[model samples]
Target: MNVATDFPLREYNTFGMDVTCARFVQIDSADEIPKMADLFDTPHYILGGGSNTLFTDYYNGTILHPAFGGIEMASQSTPTSEGTSSSSVLLRVAAGEPWENLTNYCREHSLYGLENLTGIPGLVGSAPVQNIGAYGVEVKDCIEKVEGYYTDTMQPFCLTSDDCHFGYRDSIFKHELKGRCFITHVWFRLSPQPRFTLTYKALAQALEGREPTLDSVAETVLAIRNSKLPDITQIGCAGSFFKNPVVDQAQHAALLNRFPDLVAYPTGDGMMKLAAGQLIEKAGWKGRREGDAGIYPKQALVIVNYGNAKPEEICNVYRQVIADVKDLFQVTLTPEVNII
Candidate 1:
């Protein structure tokens, strides 16, 4: 365990918020987990990649960050004498491994299932917690199991994919296990052969002329993502600041009557999911900036920090966006990022 006092978090989070926590504890190994029981009695948060996290203020409590890293083949059919893989592979990825690394690993090893998730930034541990998804494929579909420990008991635990109770951008980690569970490793089952999921229109269209292989799919997904989202390395912003608002059939009908061009898709159960970016753009907020905070011009769903924006400035802009969107569409916009 490594501990730092008043640790700066500007580099830790994607938004690059300049905030500090009273204590920052880095767990480099599983042995340290058993010794962390007492620390949980105080105010604390288990932070992973911090890519999906936005700290609104300087934290007065401890922040535990998992730093251990590794990727091992938990199970897989032996490669044939000719060196051709015969079946799916299982990978046990450490919680701290970059999500991008895992996707790249799949592409390099000719593994399928994670190619579409190529450009998403975050630690592997945060994947299931956020149920991170892109281009019609969700992480939950590949996750075989999650291994972790209870903060209170410091006892080891494991959960199957179904036990995670995954929903649209939601998981048991966000509710039942939030603050209590500390993920150590995630087990994923991926096909050795390509099993493409190009149901997403844009992804399919982009690869129409090209072969739908692991390398091509990975490259295409990253290219499409870069076209819409700003590079976090240059700009400070959490990707997709708001979730697509899901409305009932009646609400969808009402909106469509007024705005015939509205983008809406049935989400079953008589509900429709509207494109949040479209909503924000239609409301004339795209490329709009207040001080250093603004909605990304390329993707209205993202709220950005141009340079040295304070937390309140970012908050104010997003709040205003929510209010304006609500007034215009009567639908409340909910943040997809974790605002702490």
Candidate 2:
């Protein structure tokens, strides 16, 4: 266990906010989990890649960060009596492994199913917590199980996919089990066979008429994400600040009639997911900034810090965006990023 006091967190978080923690602890191995159980008695925060977290103020408590890293094929089942083996392979990935690095590794090794999630920032551990999704694929679809240590019990546990109770950008980890456990690794069930999912319009257009390979699909998703999201390294920002609002059929019809050009996607069972970016753009918030915090010019879904913007200023801008969207469309937008 590596420990520090009054540690700066600008480098740890993608937002590049210069906040300090009272106690910052880094655990590089799973064995270290038990040693820090005592620290859990007080308020503590478990940090992953810091991609989806907004440090709103100085964290007065301890920050536990996992640095464990490794990836390998965990197990394989035998062929069935019909002479066809199960095409799936289970991969055990460490909690601290970079999400993009895992996807790239899968693509290079001919592993399928992770192509649609390329270029998403953060660590593998947080994927299940957020149920990260893009281009019509959610990480929950590929997750077989999540392994973690229960903070309350100080015991390790494994939860299967069904046990996770995953939903749109959510899991038990974000609700019932929030702050009760710390993920140590994830088991992903991937395929060796070629499978392509091109449901999103932009992704389909990018590969128009071209044969989609793992490399091609992954590269296309990366391109699409890059075109819209600001490079966090260059400018501090969380990729998407708000979750797309999903409404019932009647509400959807009412909004559609008002805004003929509204971009909405069917989420089945009489629910429609409206594009938060489109709503923000229509409300005249795109390319708009106040002080040093503002919305990204290209994508209204993103909120960025130009430089040295305080967390309160960013929150103010966020509040205004939500208020404006609600006032104009009668739809409320919820934040996807965790505001700490």
Candidate 3:
């Protein structure tokens, strides 16, 4: 592990915010983590691909980047390790592995669970932190377990799926026990025979009367996302900056009177999932730019950093948009991207 001071983070995050880390260390192997941990006295933030994080200002503490990378196949057995005639597979990936790379590997290997999350950018470890999702699939659906080093105990342990408590772009890692665990690796169970899911409208439309193949689903999702979202290489953006707000049936009905054509999904528990994009667009925020920050014209949910914008400017637009949506529709929108 090599420690450096004042590291430039312009290219580290997809959002393209120019923030500097006071102390930066890259750990490429699990064996190196303990020594690195011993060197840092202050609290640290673990960064993977940096796709999901928003740096509002320069980090004050050490920034630990888990650069470890590898994948292994482990025997997939129940928690009890009972033997079975049918065999499942476990994909063990290092924390720093690019999420897209893992998805591609799964596709190439005929693994079934990650087809719907084709275009999402980030690292594998960060996926569980947010329970990252798209096109009717979420990371929690396939994650068998997460292995990490607990800062408090200074020991490594595995967390079962239920332990993660994944819920709508959130998990135990993000709340209740934030920054307590340094995830070193993750394991997932995938199917050789795919069980395809096409619940999202845009994905369904893209497929449009075709049989759902793994490649087809992935291709369609990629195409759909590429058409709307700005390329991270060109402009900085964390896809779908805010999550769709979930409201009770009564609130949905009340909002329906104001905007009858608003798109919504029934949660089956008497709550409705209203599209934040539609709300933002209706409020006239789409494609609107102030300095280097702007809302993507095609995707109201995506806030873009057009050029050399400060992180605070990006957040200002985010705050303004959320506030407007709340004032107009009486629903509070929560950001999907992690803000630091």
Candidate 4:
């Protein structure tokens, strides 16, 4: 429970940028937050798994770590005329539980719904905040409730599925209400009755036109991720540095005319999803390196901090990519990783 000053953060984030936190505190349980809150006396950022974040510069305030862990299942059922049969089971996960670990746990338990989220490196608490998604499935689809405390008021609250306001890798927790609450736990509704979702192109192709089974989907996703994303252990990188921009139909058509080979997914809401990676590669940025920062060869959307790169160097590359994409496509690429 020691709050250190000017702490080195190179080992804390996936980017491996050597930045120093002005203040740092780590908590292992929710009961400790109240006491820590008193010590904060100032604004702070909650550190989870630190997979989807970039330390552009050192923090000026306290950086708290939510280290809680544990997972529990509860039997849930609804009233019926026939009988009280279990409808769904609630899996309660601590805020600090690694997201990938939770996905693997569900896979091992024969529980469906978390398979598509495989290989996403983050924490249970941060998942809902970003509405983390991959292969056509977002975490919001499986979340039942999110329990957290109001940082300002120091009051605890519970948010149901709808309250999360999840949409396209975003949630209320991220915007409109950012930093207002500190997520402590998350509850998800997973099914033992296999209802797999493997609709994405990569997944479908991996399955070879077969039905979506939990095991197959999970395995396919893991393989795909491993092949695409850089190994954080070897190379410092935050996967998918930029978010795929969703452009309107008019813009999509304009881009299609300019680049006929452009690939996109219909949002079914007068918008089309364009892959940021494809755009980066099309812009001839793939495998490009500048100093210690570089665009990943396999996935241009990722920006890697190769070997002892400073935080500013990584931020420079991000700015360059955004500027280049805007100049070429008239589309602004937004970063998915939290740049702090």
Q: What Cα-based lDDT does every candidate model obtain? A: 0.91, 0.92, 0.87, 0.86
Cα lDDT tens digits for candidate 2, 1-340: 8999999999999888889999999999988897677898888999988999999999999999999988989976656899687778899999989998899889888888889999999999999998999998999989999998899988999999999999999999999899999999999999888888899889999999999999999989989988989898888987899999999989988998999899888887789999999999999999999998999999999999998898898999999999999999999999999999
Give per-residue CA lDDT, model 4, range 73-122, as digits (tens): 86655547786674567899999888878987888888888898888887
What is the alpha-carbon RMSD of candidate 3 to the true structure?
A: 2.7
Q: What is the lDDT of residue 118 in candidate 3?
A: 89
Q: Give per-residue CA lDDT, model 3, range 24-86, as digits (tens).
A: 888878777655556445768888888888999999888888888888877654333564444
Q: Candidate 4: worst 10 consecutive residues by lDDT?
A: 34-43
Candidate with better TM-score, 1 vs 4: 1
Q: List pairs with backbone clashes in candidate 2.
A: none
The TM-score that candidate 1 achieves is: 0.96
Off by over 4 Å in 1: 77-86
Model 1, 41-116: lDDT tens digits are: 8999888878888899999999999998888988987668998866778999999899888987887788899888
For model 1 the local lDDT of residue 136 reads 93
> On a 0 to 100 scale, what is the lDDT of residue 15 in model 2?
85
What local lDDT score does residue 216 receive in model 1, on the 0 to 100 scale? 85
What candidate 2 gets wrong by more than 4 Å, as runs, is 78-85
